[model samples]
Target: MRLVTFNILHGRSLRDGQVDTGRLAEAIRRLDPDILALQEVDRAQERSHHADLTDVAAAAMGAVDQRFVPALAGTPGAAWVPAADPDDPGTAGYGVSLLSRHPATAWRVLRLPRIPFRVPRTGPHRWPQRLAPEEPRVAVAGRFATPEGPLTAVSTHLSFVPGWGQLQLLALRRALAAVDGPVVLLGDLNLRGRQPERLTGYRPLGRRPTMPAGRPDHQIDHILLRGELGPVRLVDNPEMELSDHRPLVVELGARRG
Candidate 1:
């Protein structure tokens, strides 16, 4: 199966400020991944013309099964608060998403606790605002029905704060421990592959730089595996203006070593 991870930046094109829905659609259409993990997807946000990115992406990729995990809730281009239950899994806004060609067996959203806000040493950056007391961040997970068996897939956008991401990683590791069977974790960890074992038990398929506009010094987006699934391959989306970060795609088969 082909899999991909992308930070669409709400479908905005950095080139000429144009929204290349067709380009986005064509890319997804060509890739036609079996499973896709997407970040920064917008749903009804005024900026992207109130477009439901989840729907558009699925349609573009021709995915049969699709669902999204909201990182926060008020609207796109805004900070959000997770459900009080942190583990509620029903909230939606700016979180991660999983789109698959297979059916879904089960799904849930596990909210990762954030680091206490510090009075910015410098100042808040303009885009992708920081979390306030009200809005919390989270990771979305789904157990899907694959021909091989039940497969657990998780998608998340981790915290960008200094040491805070470590805490979020701990929470994610705990949440994933509950699943039984082959598992795949995909998303923008905001961390590099320097210490994969420390963040997640699985190994990263590739270590190519995946951040910053033009100059990427770290491999932020990753695809990891647990147990045996089959052969896996990492695919890099050719340099595009869709977002600051490039998309990473992975493919899986029915057999495993």
Candidate 2:
């Protein structure tokens, strides 16, 4: 099965600071993933033209099932004001999402601990930092029927603060342990290398750098696997240019009889 993890940066392209649904859809089609884990997804946001990015992505990829979990109720990088109307089409939210070609029988959203207060120097310093209060973060998991049996896929966007991400990772590991069958963890973890394996005991499937899409140097995005599975291979598509981070695709072989 082909699994993909991407931080879409709210579907805004680096080339043009605009969220083009058509462009986003085309990019996802190129990857053609069986299961997709996405972060920084916008839902009913004006910036994305009040479009439900997760829905757009699901339709774009023709997913059989999909789920989105909002970490924040309002738009990111803006004031921490409540949405005037929660059901309003223009009410904005930021979160993570999962889409699968196979139907999901079960699903859950795990809320992770967030730092009580923001640090002045947190996150990548290159970009402008917003001082507004931030929303809580979360991870979403789904169970799907596969030829090899039930496989649990979890999608998350962890904290970017130093040391804080590790704490969130620990919470994720605990939440996933209760899931039955094999587990596939996908996300923009913000932490790199063997640390995830050390924290969660799930082996990393790929070691390619995915951030700063044009010239990546850190392997923050990942696909981690637990339980028995065949050899995995990374599907590199350097031409993908939708988000600031490059999408990660990996092919997992079915279990041998």
Candidate 3:
């Protein structure tokens, strides 16, 4: 099966500095993900032409089951409120989405911890030190009846703050304790390398640099496994025209005999 995690940057292509739905659809169609997790998705926003990006991705990949979880209600980088309803898709908000071809047996939406005020930090190519305010982060989860068996998957975007992301991850781990099976986490974690593995005790299924789509050096996007699965067949980041980060694709050998 192909599992993918992508930070779409709201479907705005850096190549042309515009939000093109057709471009976004084509990009998603290429991955052909059986399970897709997307961050920075916009819903009913003017910037993206009032497009329901989650619906677009579902259609592009032929996914019958999907959910959009908004961390904030309203427009991103502008007026908005911290969205508490995980199932709410009507509000104009930006957040994460999970789409799957298998019918979901259960669904969950979780709100992650975030820094309420601006914090100073050094960015890769950004200013030496810039105060940036982080929007509320959220996660969406679903349990599906796959040919392999019942699989549980969670997708989330964590805080970018130095130590805060780890804390948020820990909180998320606690939140997901009740899930019936080993969880596969897919998202732009913002925490790189063994950090996520060590914190969640979930091994990384695959990894590749995905930031700064033009020339990625740091791998912030990931697909992690909390329990046993088939050997990883392949892992790669496909170059795309949209978003600052490339999409991470991982192919697994099989479920079991």
- Candidate with the greatest lDDT versus the true structure: 3
Model 3 lDDT per residue over 1-257, tens place: 88999999999998789999999999999999999999999999999999999999999999989998888888875688888753465678889999999999999888877787887756567775666567888889999888778899999999888898898899989998877776899999898778999999888988789887999988889898988777799999989979999999998888676
Candidate 2: which stretches are off by over 4 Å? 81-91, 121-132
Best-to-worst ranking by lDDT: 3, 2, 1
Please tell me which model should have the higher lDDT, number 1 or number 2: 2
Query: What is candidate 2's lDDT per residue for 121-208, written digit by digit as tens?
Result: 3456665455544457788899998777789999998888888899999999987887777899999998987888889999888778
Candidate 2 has which clashing residue pairs, if any?
none
Candidate 2 all-Cα RMSD: 2.8
Best candidate according to TM-score: 3
Clashing pairs in 3: none
Estimate candidate 2's alpha-carbon lDDT, on a 0 to 1 scale: 0.83
Better of 1 and 3 by TM-score: 3
Better structure of 2 and 3 per lDDT: 3
Per-residue lDDT tens digits for candidate 1, residues 171-229, read: 88888887899888888877776555566778666556777646776678888787778
In Å, residue 199's CA in model 1 sits off its true spot by 2.5
Please, what is the whole-model Cα lDDT of each candidate in the order they appear? 0.72, 0.83, 0.88
